[model samples]
Target: MTTATPQKIRQLVDKLELEAALAIMATVEHPTAEIDYLHGFSLLQVKRDLPRALELLRRSEKAGFAPFWVKYMQAMCLSNLGRRQEALVALSSALGIDGQHVGALNLARLWSLELLREHLPAETTNILKTLERLIPIQTATAPAAKATGAAVRADTNSDAITTDDALMMALLGNPRLFAAPLVPSSGVSGAGIGGTISAGHAQPARHPGLVAVSERLMGRRLTVLDLACGKGGVVLDFLLRGHRAAGLEGNPTYQQRPEGHWLALADHLHLVDLGAMTTGFGEDRFDLVIAWDLLNKAPAATADRLLRLVSEQLLAPDGLLLAWAPPGADDDGDPDGWIRLVPPTGLCRRRPPVTPAELPVLPGLVPVFHSRPEAIPLVQHPHRPVRVVRGRNGLPALREEHRDDLPRVAVISVPKAGTYLVGHLLKTLGYIDSGAHAGMGGFDDYRDLSPAEAKQGGPHLARHIGLSELTRLLHGGQFLVGHIPCTFANRRDLDGFQKLLLLRDLRDAVVSHMRFMADAGRAAGQDWVDIPHGPDRLLRYLQSTGRIYMQMVAGVRPWLDVPDMLTVRFETLMGDQGERQAAATIRALSTHIGLQKPPAWNRIRHQVLGQPTKTWSGQRSRRDGLWTAEVENAFAALGGVELNVAMGYSA
Candidate 1:
């Protein structure tokens, strides 16, 4: 029997004539490794048959054909099949064979960071280091050019080219990788990854500001556009409210009809080149335009051009444009005249200050909302500003009437006291949603401000938003959750707000803190604050930090005295009676916040408890006994007993 040439088989595969290619290969008397690999590749890419693809790839591996590529494909198939551990090993084998293989290295870094960060910290670090070295560095003078199709081909062997390089090339061309479904394992601490508030479902407890704004615009026929709408979560929420809404996303991949199950309103999403000024939308097409986190990422010129285009072509006359403006964005060429709805604060020290001429501007747009500097410090971004502007194309500007009667609530807690859990529960119950604000500076206490301090240009507190601004947020139905120390200065800010203070056993909190610090240290590549491993280190650190901890506890003392303030013990929420305790806490919170009707408690309960609990060390259970008598005596000597009693814990 004679065999068809490899070149002929390749041509058939290239044309996507998979059946013909397979038929041709079957006639080959003794098939080569290349034949097996090509058949497998076609099975995986063309037919999307994972099981058959894996089978063929394994056969190709046995035939000793392109071992690295075969292993890599096997790993991808295994991952898709949910065999993550096996996938990791296959990926590792591929990398071992060809250390410089970019695709395999990228996958290794992603998988290790996602699934094995705790189990394989060193390996994760090495993968990151390899990626850093392999990825070209870009400088101001010469930007990193997108790799062309030919360049991608040049980077890989011909057989390997069809598998790994094609995927990487697709990713390079699409640029909408940000819109990829977030892997469940990739979420950082205090971040909400899943369980989005679906359209028309009761509003989520998070992002109350968005809900309040949406409510104000309700009862009107308005066309809304979300610019650069990554994953279109916010746009879906708008659609649920029965509004005529559309999302313009730059990523081509995200522009496709989203999974119908996830979004029934996916038809409204459109893909456009956000980098281009002319988006082809008709003039005055949208009544409201939202551009979140877009301008800050673009070059100054591109940003200015995009804003002008948005104002002139996209936004209706008198339409509102809500944008995020980092500090220094308001300096000189303020073309859009974006008024800071909230005072700006530098969120990170590494951010360079924006000069007047460098500030993004859209000509003819004017700020309708002016910020009052005298209001309470808005600590969230401290450095970044939320700008609201009106496209003044000879139309009457719509004014936002502040609703003063909305219920306001605040959730305050010490660090590492399961505040995230409480916040998640509140979100599930359809209360104020502030998920965006969870990891921001405003959610932190003064101790957490040290990083912001290095970036501060003037008085530390000067960057904070004033009480008036905070009141405005509350009036807009914002839910404030933070670890803000209850200082006298912050008391006035807390006044009249329904408050909830979350407490945990100090010892447990200390243990949690130690684990958190260690994890964070490893992640940041920093030393663990001079503390050694074991109980002695924990005890000594607790002793040294007792005053700060006491201060945190003391901050809540005044709130405890307030009749309306709800106090929740963290242990109860974690105990065997956790569900009952959580339900009761929710009820107390609902009443305090003046909810007209209670949320679906059972549903919220399931959502809250169903979440996978994250633990740092299995030894955490054993460490409870690590507080020896001497440690207890030392802690008491440092005033832990008084603080413990004040917080309702038996010391």
Candidate 2:
């Protein structure tokens, strides 16, 4: 086959007649080994036919072709086919056949050593001897589109190439050669693989932070050249981040796409040949060039050559290079001597990103941002909102919080309305071991104190007893029953700690509050009601028909964060005290706070368990059916659409 000159290849590419160029090459026999390999490489660039390129190389290998170059190309194909393990195998074979093949050596180092650090740790130290040989390519100086192409031309000189036919055929024919060499066998760790007859040493140790950074950068836009992109994790990171990225691997098996349903997902990826990457891509084509873990695996000169290739062809002008490898030793034994190869600077200094409030600081590399957890405030009842915060990490803190608040009782009274009915029931049921409050300053309703009396006492007691103190008391094993609004967000100082929220349906709640205020004669204050005369009118008119449904919804929001809470509807509790049902829920709360069920089960049962849904309608001459229909339609527009009719509310 007549070997196509670089100018000829350029001309064919310009003309968009790549196939014709390949046909011409087929006609020329025993073209220089370089020509044969370049011919296969050229076909790969223009047509992007990995299979065809593999076949061409296979044929070349059979005809006493360059085995090292052929095997390298085979690795690229295998990597593309999603056969990373196979690709690594081919690269190793190529290196074994011709240790002096710098491109293949670097490619192997980058893939097995750098990119796949998560899988291989021994490759870190392998690149140390090769450090000084790395010459920076003039990629930054070249114009964007021309940079990569220029490097390829420089590296593709036929006279500079070497070949090994035995290595090439082995790579081309064997699928197993494409797999990674680092995979652990049976019971052995990945590092325990016995070395080939000559090359044996301890496996490399991969750095965790580098692996994490690479994972994070995956799917993000990275103008990267894997130099040895092994299994495509680096490129995959860019792709996942919705960036246009590609890779170059020398193993032909690495370049070939695998056969699987997943092939459909890789339709847009471009896996170019290692030689062609230098030969094909324009200068400064990539924004960032990465050569992971390659330093320790290859010879010094080859390592230097690969770095030069990266500098000249891959790196973009303002691009950053993320070089991942093991720590290097300096005068002392500190792990700080990690190195990077740039222009005159040689190695860039590493710095960690600053941390912000409520967030952890990023280490090693400069960070953009960090995140942590937070707590938001919530409104449980009309009066108090709930704010949950993390308290002590153990039960001991809970015990301290509850030690002093035990036997804490909330005194509730009703005037004319039925609020006292609930208080009376609680007293009757032994939930609260106290009588109703004794004062009445104003108002007309249940046995509750007047508005004037409640104001003076409520705030004073709240300040003195403080929620924090109460929480502590509860945590220490005390029984607390109260007539409070369930609003706790207002008391910022009080931590919920080991607490259990108790709630009942809005219908019963409004009815109870109305009566409690009426009996107290406004001692609790008109502030408790949303509107003037609301408590009594609501009690008389809509108590049983869901008239206060909106208030019910508003009340539950605060307790959302309380880890230990038990909710009961008044009507449901009116049924039976099912030991299994109520006990199970109580047990869960007890377990959460590290407590056993209280011995006073029956006494606490009536207060904490269910209650009957109390319905109310005064003596009236109106027929039950008429009242039902009217109440149903009337409350439907308000809050009691269905139950109003069932009770007796008329339209």
- Best-fitting candidate, scored by lDDT: 1
Q: Taking the tens digit of each residue's C-alpha lDDT, what string does model 1 give over 1-651?
A: 444478888788777788888788767777677777887777666546789878778767755567677877788887888766457656656654565555565566455434523333352464333323323222213222111111111143321112221222222221121122211121112222221211212212123245234323221224567766655555644443333466655554433332211132234555455565354353225545667555555666666666666654665433455565545545534523232212232111112122223222334321121122221122223343333223222212111222233455677776566665676676565554432222111322222233323223222232233332443343323366655544322443454466788887776776676666554442132233465666676676565444445445544554565444688777666654666776676677777766667675565666775353232233332246567877687677756677778788887
Question: lDDT tens string, model 2, 253-299?
Answer: 43332321112113222333333223425422454455444434554
After TM-score superposition, the amount by which residue 77's alpha carbon in candidate 1 deviates from its true location, in angstroms, is 70
TM-score of each: 0.35, 0.24
- Residue 369, candidate 2: Cα error in Å is 47
Error of 2 at 130 (Å): 50
> TM-score for model 1?
0.35
Residue 650 lDDT in model 1? 86
Candidate 2 C-alpha error for residue 78, in Å? 44
